[model samples]
Target: MSLSYVGTQLTIYVGSAILIAGVLGNGINIFIFSSVRTYRNTPSTFYFLVGSIHNLLYLAINLTFRIVSVGSGFDLTRTSLAWCRARSFFLSTISVISFTCSCLATIDQFLATSQSAHLRRYSKIELAYRIVLVTMVVWYLQGIPWILYQNISPISTTCVRTNAIYAIYVSVYLLLVLCVIPVVVMIGFGFLTYRNIRLTIALAELRADRQLAKMTLIQVVLVIISIIPYGINNAYGLITTGMTKDANRILIESFISTIVSLITYLYYMGSFYMFLISSSRFRHAYHTLCDNTTSNSSSLLCLVDDDYFCLCDINQIAQCFLYDKTLDQCKHCLAQGQCIKGDTDTPSDYVCRCPRCHFGSICQHNTKLFSFTMESLLSPDLLSSSFIKKSVSLSMYIIVPALLLIFGTISNIFSFVTFRRPKTRLNGAGHYFFTSTIFSQLSLFCLLSKIIHIIINLRGLFVQPMVNTILCKILSFLLSSSTRICYWLIVFVNIERLYVTIYPTKRWLKEPKTAKKIIIFVIMLTYGVHIHELIQYTIVPDPKYTVHGKWCVTQFSHSLQIYNQINTMIHYLSPCLVNLICTITLLIRPARIRANLDKKKSR
Candidate 1:
């Protein structure tokens, strides 16, 4: 086979493997959760079952589509429009629902476990019914755009515009529903979860197995990673689809879409492992299964003591950081022990001692009565940071910024209302600039903040093997670009004010309507300047967590670092520069003119 053919085969196999893994993994969870008669009746079971259902559907579609697309031999561009639209609509909907269901599972775990007595008694059947209703509403809600604008036929695998007007309508609707609404919901929930976690931690409430909340956080990250590639792909598609008939971009986007689909499954599959690591029950069960299946396995060499689980072969902890073989000492306490000791045991095999109050086993003490206290956990500093972090919690991220935008818009409305008032009809140029600033701030605020958090938060929740060097750079660029929009708007405000004062009779400054048009134009232009950032910062797996059995994103390139510096320069330094220059000009201009007039009068 040609290298191309081999690559294609590998892709298909990988996709299949991921799909099977997710289905079987989640299916086993379903069986285990269901077969236990006591477990089947619990309210939490409903969420777990529903989340599994969504995962199964998502995996099936993803696996089938990827395998078919790879082997089908037909130009993706030449596939039937119906096939394209239907596939697009269903897959997107399922993907969204999967993430949403997972999030709901987290929420359910919180409410169910936290409030055990009266609230715990809520019927599983009623919970299932409510989920069904929600599923129905969400399905129809997401399907509207598909029904209205989806054009699938065999000739070309692409979206068919009902017409330009309808296309715009569908785009607007889809943007609001898929992109905007979920982002808002995620941000809200993220904030709430952050607060709850902090409070739990602070109040000494977080036990060893607070897996649900962490699982929820991981789910959020999955959504972010899944959406980002798709979001960028779609956003780019929307911008360039009509302007350039480039096959490469389309193909590139399709590849990204496929990758994102696969990663979404990875997110679902990986969470079970996270649960296994964090939850004692899952960990115990998993280890029991592993031991039962492979009596003579290499893993059998591992030893578990009261303080630590050790991998004999590697001389390291089962899950945590590796021992520094070269140092042969506790790098964690390097200040005291810089050199390796003569002891045969590796540092990784050494049990991790608590920062304070070194006593018996660290894990055992956690469960001991009066060993921990809410007062100790909920320290003054911890509480303060919790308040701040919660105030800016990821869930409320969208609403807070959105509310700020609304307030800015309201400020404009006030200006307009004042202008229309009989008493204030003769409002001056300052009023016009103030009104203009309101609209500018509103537009930039809504677009930049919402889009940023939507993309950023989703990445945090979902992206696996988290370090995608390329993706990190792309994200950094997009962030820089988004922030630039705000800075540029501030510059415009200062410039407009200075212009009106310096040349009041200019036709541009005379009409408030003209100023509004300019503001809108600037807002639109902001996208053009930063579009390159999205392209430059492509998604790649994070490096730090990959080796240690954790996943996350981090920037790899200095290009993003440069861009960040530039953005900071513009956002902070430029605004300050503009303000400083304006302030000095306002102060000095009058004094200079008066001095000249006095000189003329004496002459």
Candidate 2:
């Protein structure tokens, strides 16, 4: 196989950029959070730091593959099945570790911030170890997909080998374990935290109130934001079924899918930012470190081979950032008074170049620089060419969504019916809310799966405004409505929890009739919002026009796109804001109440 110079160069450039960025960003994070003695060891930070490490590892694996594939055209059979299995296993484990760590962090915050002593006791090291061990088990168990699917097909040009049946089973497993479990857990934990927060506020427990509330908001938002893109992407992969031998189509789809997969990294990256935003201690420490650039503090610098640079105090960090750059002090800078006393020639520090800077360096005079835009990132020609090469079928499309809808319906119904009985009713509103969440999850999963199925199935069909007229509309509507339904269900549960906690004596909550009504109303209202999707997903096919083929499960009309973006903002972004606002309000109310009590006692 021969590689185009441009393709090889681009691969190297992108791979290098990703590796460098991941190393620095995750390195600084681990150092600041782990080594700093002042950080007051919290379970939240521990989980977060570990998660960052996992993210860096994930980046390393991805970068390694990108570089190797570009250089050698990525031959799987030549590399042996062992190499494939190893790569798959490493990738899978790191990915799991990243999300699992985030989950643990959320769980930690929820427990730590909760008002109940029983819940608060969950902040033990033993529990953390147990969680970590269990997560590892989950990772290995999930590796069944890789073990089952690992093979070398004669026609496959790429290194990775995947089959339709293997993909479907893995997709089903991933959807259930990773995507659905986290969604349900986030909603459940968020509600539990909200409830405990309200109780704390009523009792004037300000510290716990603020901490728990902020952490809850951060965890919920970060998890949701990061998971959705990758989740949807995987859902598409699962529904679209089959392993094509087409090198061109596979490469193009894989490249685009790689960008989508970055959503997982975004989730990991956002945690540091969330901590910066929501926790004052983190913010103060970060700001203080940034502002004091002149300070020769050990915290900021490490001597490496007689040159100064940053070092982190972790196994992962040290492994990632140990630089071997030769010592070359900035002679020009020293002569120009840019260097301080005793500063001979030192190696140029790795600095971030501005996107708008002309040169990839810190310019003395700022000049405009060109960077890759979204248009360049996703070229129209590339998309069209990729679409042209796609060998897709109607059955692939139909069966995938049908499978998802069926699976979702069955899972959600089981969750609801099993917990609906009088026997499990005493399990509390947490269990009931869990059931409701499963319904929303199924709704979202089915809608996405169904739509992708339609678009792919209809690609080569000559039916114009005939076969797909009604189907498109219903598919589109159901997808949108189900997603909305699921999003709002979570918020409803959170708000209900707040109500129950603050007003525990309310007889309405105790009444089975009232609870049932609330559940029905929430479910009905959620599905009602999805009605629009039912109306709009359908499109009139043109006899002369071939549908643009791709693996993503989304409607691309401007109006629909705008609506979905808004949906993302409302269901995805806005709830985060609500979580933050509610948490702050809950915390502040108690602080003010406590101050008044203190004043009274002093008087």
Candidate 3:
């Protein structure tokens, strides 16, 4: 594979891993810090809590966008000016806030561990909270200039600093403020923390109290190790910006930078693991929490989110055993959302907290209202890819769609042949019917493609990014456009039939040439109406997969969703109304004609 392709795949696989690990680690840290009474009382753990919160924010907002943009080539910042400004603003603000918290935590660890009573007094939870608030406000204020000055440049078409001076200021800010200053603070405090540990441990009275302190010291070491390389990478980039480099050298530098960028994410994803690794008490506490033992700690109420709180028995993290019984049970939410970690109070110890538009007890229901994908309908019942493929019974999704394709292929071919005859080309309906059959057949194949797509991803098979993107966009467009156009074509047919009935005496030869042009017009109009299906759909990584794979997903903005609803009403509902009116008119018009003929005969 080419370097670009290799780089893209690396981002997809590696970036996905980082996103998952980072979110889980940071979230677990928050849960542990907030739940444990001993932890909640400490100023250093308070800063760690704040840092973890920002780490979650940073990973959710920035790393997600990076994977989507670089791995899948759907960069939202390029298209939306609002996203361009907001993304950089949050990214910078959160990075700084998290780093600041890290620095504060390191300093607090030193203060809390020291023998001096006055220094220990400085490590109050209240003071830590105030410091975090002030740091957030300061960093957020610093980031306002980014929102105002960030723009999608005409040349690069990437988010750029429109002001040269501010761009330089940002680079300097990243280098000195986030990188150099935090590293210095962490290293300095870390040294003092070690010295305090030696002095305090000699007294032999403060061992339990020093467990968190030791965890913080190790965290400080991680902070320095992760931050120093990032700082060096930035310094190198800045130093070499004006220098002309050959293609090979530039490519090598780009690869190195990518690796360094991944390393920088380690600080955010590493804290929980760092604690587990360094401190035996912390590890024991984690184990105790997982085992749900009430021996050491009482059941404490923990805030799960703003809306809900859970009583923690202190054992499993949120939804640890989403696979309580088997691998299938583990992926019971179909791997779409978090499981609320639970105890034996209920039938299951985990409740699925689904992503947006998904629901049901185990998150089995997807609110893809009016979506026609067969795979969606069968998602709740889907088994492991291996089990489904190896079992004798075909899935409902496969069986029903498979049968429909078989009959659909046969029927459309027969219709196409019937419409092909010169005698059938008497009016517009014949032409419309002919084209409808073509899209009908196309739609069936698209259905077949969808089934294959689901199965391939079900088995966790990787497709190249560019090819996958194209398939995702094209398959969705064809299926949606064909569905819409088929409905409208039926409406058009009824309208044509009504026209012929009303003015049958005015005999003008309806040539196929005119019919052909009209068909082209209708086709163009149909595609134009549903064009957003192509623009809005994209391939995103599927966490359900054991190996690297993607799911073809569509997301519409609020305005677009509104437009789509209106659009669906127009394409889907309008045809039914038009056809209903046409059918009624054709029936009534013939009876009225018969009545007039009877009156003439009596005369």
Candidate 4:
């Protein structure tokens, strides 16, 4: 047989096995995470639960479609534009939502282990729900663009991007959003969370936190590994598109693409196994679920409250021996190996007891077989020192922000007052500085509100209404707009200074009226550019603290990439480039002047 045929056959068999195993595992994960009270209540578990559900859907839809298409040359998605769009939309939505939940889970852990009590308190079950809801809405909307862009070819039964540019844009976007951003955030937050857990004071909480962190970290590492090949393939395609194609290049690209597809399948299949291997709690829950299914317990109550007799008590020797002597009572006991003839107090009465690690009257429940000990892994002094370090970290959280807020507020106020004076305002460059100081003051005010919020949250007295939508939107706008305006204002001031240095004869450039006009233009231009923020940013309710009120956040996903690119250009890159050019020009002008003077002297 040809190598291609062999490889194809292997892929079909392996993919089928993965589909079955992943569906079964993820289905069980969903059941346990959703049903178990202890797991259900946890914020990280909520994220994991949502992720598992999406993963199962992804595996069912994507894997089954791939397997069928490969084996029988059947492609449902290629039958119509609507089907293609729907398939593309759902594929992107599920993948993004799954990864987003994982990212949120990582962030939730970081917040839960934060040195700040206020931040830690934010890690609640209700918050997880809100985040998941927001994520779903955002990703579903994000998939709309894909639906619009994807089409089925009329000549060939295939789905493809509408054009090469769109394809390139998507490849780069996916690389950043799916791979780069998630990997960076997970690793960065994972490091911080690990450090925080190491310094946790309570032994029980420490162990639990450590296990969860380790589980999340391992899953994140695996996800990064699986996606790296896909990212490289996307990047390679983006760079090599429209280039001269050769057979060797085509062969190499084909190999990479195949490998990428296989690894991506593994990504969808591996999460359940990762949890099983890395998490003892997950294993215990799985075992408990299995035991419950096999046991004759009609209700979970019978498993916990074993004292009460239920309909499932048919195997109970004591009940059988107590009520009826006509039946061979010891015969039932002998079958269980828990009792023999004359072993009990009497023939009619019997003693029934389960072996170790078994519970319930009939020994139907199986408890966890292994106990984990961390004392051997962690030193006693380290545990004691963690308590002291935590107290110090908490104090720093309060003190550092407070000092910065107080000093920054005072400095900005003084700068604003000094620059607003008529003597300073008349100077062209001073006007720009004055406007910049005003923005600086506004920015400081926003910072002050944040610090105050933190303090109030620390005291457990903060109300949610204080962070309502209007406040959140206004604060976000002010922070972003003010920061951008400050950057541009500084750039304008530097350019104005360079203008006067290079062209002293241009008197109009030094006029306060000219400076005033430029300032007005800068304000209008920045406000126009950032107007979308006013619409996109709004107050979202904290699911856990609805009574207290909501916090501000941006909604929608379609325009965010474009919006961010514009902001980066206007706020950061453009200003830096302008300032650099002006500085170089100004420096070179003085050198040119001295060089001309030397030439004149020699003449």
Candidate 5:
């Protein structure tokens, strides 16, 4: 048999073993961490619980996919676009979540063992849940682009990226997310944790503290070791693509690829073993759990030694198991000013469960130094009353727009009259200013119409008047075209000023005719670009709102999102960039001119 065939067979056998062992191990880890009260309450264990779940999923999905594809020669992921996208999305998202949870556990351990009380208090179960929730949301959103751009190849019957650029982007993104960022965070925090342990050896000697630090260090080291080879392989593949076509080089790359694949799987498998070997507490918990199962006991009692498990009477066991044993004494609650004694039936339940911000088993933390409710400051009903609502509406939609319309119309008219005087009419600069005032007046008219529409809608007086197809199209087209023209006319005026400032001897650029031609071109260009508004926008019936009423709506294609992005870049961002450049040049020109004159005088 060929060496490649032998290697493939060996991988199949070894991979199957690893898959079974990893699934069993992670399943046990989850059961023990969740069942034991000691492990369940601690913050780092929450991260470990979540990480174990993610690792189990990663191993099962990834290993099973590989096994099936290799053994039966059937690749389900290559069957359709949905499968391809789903396969990539799940694989990437789950792997990243697993790594994130591991990193969080390390950080939590460091904080929990810190000498600073503020940092130590941050190690709460609620905070761990919040962090995990945010991580899942962020990673899931990050996978959306992958789903949008992945496709199935018809020739090779495999899933691949749709664009070469996107392929390169995914490679770089994975390199950073999977390797670079994680390595840096783990190494930096790992070093700090080690130093803290060394300096505070007496504090670190506690069993719980030592266990947390040891487990976290082992996890960090395992993560760093497992990911390095995969990262290197990714970098090599990205660098070597299309570079050479030698058969020997191809074989070498394939060998490295297989080794990296195995190494990646090793990461998923090694966590359970790491926990088992690094912590005696975890081992003892596992053994007790196994012993209980073998003895066929259905009791809730998790019998660790007398010190670990909170042993109490049968009735007290339920309360102690549910909450901390410290609550039974009620000293912490009595110290706070909120204790309530219980009746004869359950006299031990003297701790009052205050429904406010206080910590500890008996609510002794007293987070509220100055007790006050949010409603006392600002009531929701008061804010939502008719007077406040109308005041805001009148100021925004009525008063502001009305004042702007009045001032803008009067100013534009005065400017027109001033520019038409004999002394200004023949000036090239006056022509540009004159054209700009005209477009600005038109733009103001469009704005006034829109504000009136908003006011009418707010009053609920016009249900379907503007919903007519022709009216909708005409209003949209007029508003967009006028606004664009107004902005571009300002740009033209700036350019004219810049030209005059730079080359005072250029007579053609100083002509009024040139200004007029540029104004005509600006108007035409703005109209042509926004002509789509006339066709794309129309009236659609709104059955949910009113039976006979319609709404003005614009129908969009899949490419509309891309078009919107390009439109924003060109119309909004391009003008700002150009205006900034021109302003800077204008500011610097005087200084440069003065410097040149000074040099000439000295010569």
Candidate 6:
């Protein structure tokens, strides 16, 4: 299997494991730290409490999407426009908050361990509360740029940054704020806290304070280990973005990126486990709490002896899964889906991990990206390999193309001839009409070539490989550019008429000189924008993913797709919209003058 696919399968389980473990661990941490009166008001513990909540939020929202995205191979952010803008905003805001809380907990521990009374006083619960509140507000405000910049990219059909300047700022922010600052602050304070306890173990460090210090300090080390690799990966990505690589190298890089991204979640999930390892008092608390639980009777507690291995077997794990059949966990499931019980002990803890199309937690959405192509739309049940032969009778395909070519040629020639007269060329309107007629002829000829190319390939006809390649590039390039040229020429025609409508007395408005310049500019601009077709377009033989016999195809890069689609829209819509507005305004505010007539009365 390719590493990307393998990595995707791994993430399906890994993300689930993290979600379950994180929720349970952080859940217990929150309960023990809050419910136990001895630890309730301590500033370090307060930060721990808040950090646990942030970790839960991170796992629930971010890691859940990460798992669904991998399992289905479709990102929700890309498909849903609101989510495209909101996911980045929330993830950034919440992650920075979680990282900030970790730092605060470490720094608070340092102060709690310090010999100085002044620095120690700074570790107050009231100040901790205010700091977290202010941090939330600041980071929420900081994430506003993401709301403004994140968008569903048209080319790649994925969510990505839309603004160049904002994208650069995001890269810098990812490197420094999310990756660097928290690690630095925690490590620095973590060591200081450790040194204070080591130097003055007998002087004044209480047992609880020492345990909390050890927990936070050990957690800091884990943070550095988990987070620094993530930072380095981000830097490597930035450095190598423009470098070209073979397909295998691209897959390898993608595999590594996926692996590193999963590892980054470890920092958020490992804290409670870190506490369990570093604090004996914390472990004692866990046992004491678990032994006392009466809510769910089905439990398994495994204890391994130093002298021998012991296995604890408990029946009735699914007892809680069926605790509430009326809960309707399978409401979002597709056909033949099975729900798996999770979330430790809750009755509402079922996630629908289906055998097919595991799209969401409950399998609610479609598993694949949906799109339409000409062959598919025309004959949904027919074989795509021999498209034209299978979809069309021999006579029908021949007759349609013949009719189109004859009528199109005649109409364009007639329009060209009509606009060629000197009397008709007295104004810019005639020039625009003549240019459009020429473009229309160009479009018709390209269309005929495209039809011939498709028919030859699909009907099992042979052409030389190099000839096919050249035809593929030339035909697609000429067709797209010529069609867009026509659209833009119409746009300019509307604009010129609108100008004449507004300024009837301006003699320059009636000249054909500016019209000629604009037509040339439109043709050049359209050709320039579509020049990528010459390089990006190519013939693919017997490909299942795209349409046509020559099979002209190129996958859109994320930013390029969004940009190209928007540009096409502007070219297509600008003229139609300009025409509507101009015609309506011409109707609304009739001009005072007319060409070659008396200056009209003021409306």
Model 1 C-alpha lDDT per residue in residues 1-603, reported as the tens digit of each score: 544555577666666566555655576566656665644554445556666676777666555555645644322323456565666667657756765665565555455434233543342457755875688587758666765566644454445665678777556655555555555566566666566545543211222224445555556665566555545555665776568657765566556665655554576565444444444232221222233334445544443323343333322113322344444444432102233344546433433343222122111112111122111222222223466764455445455657767776677677666656645423234444454445555454545443443345334553443344443444444444545555655565566666655566775753556655665665567566555545543332222212222111222243443343333433545455455545545554455557669989999
Winner on lDDT between 1 and 3 is 3
Which portions of model 1 show Cα errors greater than 4 Å?
1-10, 37-45, 74-89, 109-125, 137-151, 154-184, 201-209, 245-257, 282-603
Give the local distance difference test score of model 3: 0.71
Q: How do the candidates rank by lDDT, highest first? A: 3, 6, 5, 4, 2, 1
lDDT by residue (206-318, candidate 3, tens digit) is: 32246777787788788777888889989998898789999988888888777778888888888877876676443212222333445546555232332222334444332
Which residue runs of candidate 5 sit more than 4 Å off their true CA positions? 1-3, 203-208, 282-603
Candidate 5 lands at a TM-score of: 0.47
Global CA lDDT of candidate 4, please? 0.65
Q: Residue-wise lDDT of candidate 2 within 327-363, one digit each (tens)?
A: 4323222001122223344343333222222211221
Candidate with the greatest lDDT versus the true structure:
3
By summed lDDT, which 10 consecutive residues of candidate 4 come out lowest? 369-378
RMSD of 6: 23.4
RMSD of 5: 23.6
Better of 2 and 5 by lDDT: 5
Candidate 4 wrong stretches, greater than 4 Å: 1-3, 163-165, 201-208, 282-358, 361-364, 367-603
Residue 391 lDDT in model 4?
Answer: 57
- Candidate 6 structure quality by residue, lDDT tens digits, 1-603: 779779888887777676666766777678778886657667778888888888888887788777756654446686688988888888898889889989999988888767665776687788988998999899999999999988888998898999999999999899999998998899898888888878763311222256778889888887888899899998998998789999998899888877887888888888877886687453222222232243445355433211222222243111111134333334333333465556546655666655332233333222221111222223222343676765565446556767887898999888888999888888887888888888788877877776666667654465587888788788878877787788777766776776776577885756788778877888888888878767865555432322433344433453454445445545555555446644644543342223213434433
What candidate 6 gets wrong by more than 4 Å, as runs, is: 204-208, 282-603
